[model samples]
Target: MRHSLPGGTLVLHPDELHDGEAGTEAGFRYRMIYVEPVVIQQILGGKPLPFIPTGLSTDPRLGLVLETFMQSIDAPLERLEEEDALFDLAQALDAVGNKRRGRRAYDYQAAERARDYIHASNGASITLDELEYVSGRDRWSLSRDFRALYGTSPYRYITLRRLDLARKMLLGGFNLVDAAMAAGFFDQSHMNRHFMRCYGLSPARWLSMLGRQTCTIVQE
Candidate 1:
């Protein structure tokens, strides 16, 4: 479903196929917070994932909670304060989910197998066809089931894993080029694009911000 959310709107988007476009000529600015399905499951104590019917809201209370959560991330707050902010956001989501809760069954085992194969790859290249073959499910079914179970598509999941590896290698003193290549990117430029998209900054900028030294090649 296509949505054109306005400013100050709170969106409760599910792990489903959806896209957005600019609503007006001036463009729009929004802050997004992505919560993993497992985190929500833990919050709900194993309740089936909740589905928000409309997915768009202008609720001021939810908006305030989201703002607080975002602020807590950047602020030098105590660990308990951060936890309290997170719980507030989770509870807000749970309240919405309770309003229109529903569930759909999918091939859990097949999805699990695909997830396991991706984990075993460890920054190696992966393809949907390979996932299908390993999981004994068709590409479309596997993709749907995987998203249902993991809150992201398979290729996106792979990219996230690669990003994780690249971050670790960078912290371990690997240079940008080596870390990018070793983490399954084509080169530094390729990794830079994804790093910017996912983390809102380039790898070099991120490293410098963290005050981590580079190019030392620490022994693993």
Candidate 2:
């Protein structure tokens, strides 16, 4: 029930329970595409769903196409381009469905405890000693396992969590200064630097784009 998936894995769940846990030591960021059953029926000409025995794949080509499909969602691409990307992704997935590979096992319970503590803190500053106390792992081991499982260091993960909170506040009509402070940043400039580095754009610019997009949708 609590299987650990490595990075670059793709999963397909068809008409079954697909449950996962986050805020754990092995938590990960991922992209998901949902295809309706009607759409699947049309694509398969009313045939049964493709039987992907294991429902998992680590094919590099499939990963590349999946990444392209994800980027097409946000990129300023034409509708046809997006469709092409999706088609390619589907084909790549079909090609890898029958292939099998071994799964890797890992033990990171202490690191998971640290991750849970970090989430519970809710953007507050966390110390290494606190993590050690909560997780029973030394700073070095915690840091190593945390990065291995979550793909980021503990300090970076904390900063990313604050950034996420600040982004949400900004989208919910909070001003820059308020969002920054409430998300645990020292000030607007502090949030600005990290936000720009992470998103490749300033908050003001991103917000402006969002406003324009909303206006366009409303007008249309």
Best by TM-score: 1
Q: Report lDDT per candidate.
A: 0.71, 0.67
Per-prediction TM-score, please? Answer: 0.52, 0.48
Model 2 C-alpha lDDT per residue in residues 84-194, reported as the tens digit of each score: 344444445555664332343444999899999989988887777688799997554565467679986676788889999988988888888888888988778778877
Candidate 2: where is the Cα deviation over 4 Å? 1-107, 212-220
**Local accuracy of candidate 1 as per-residue lDDT tens digits, 1-220:** 5464654554555656566667789887777777776655654556666665577766666786677556645544333234334545555666765655456568999999989998999988776667879999866557657767898667678889999999999999889889988998877777887799799988888888899765533445
lDDT of 1: 0.71
Q: Against the true structure, whose lDDT is highest? A: 1
Worst 10 residues of 1 by lDDT: 76-85
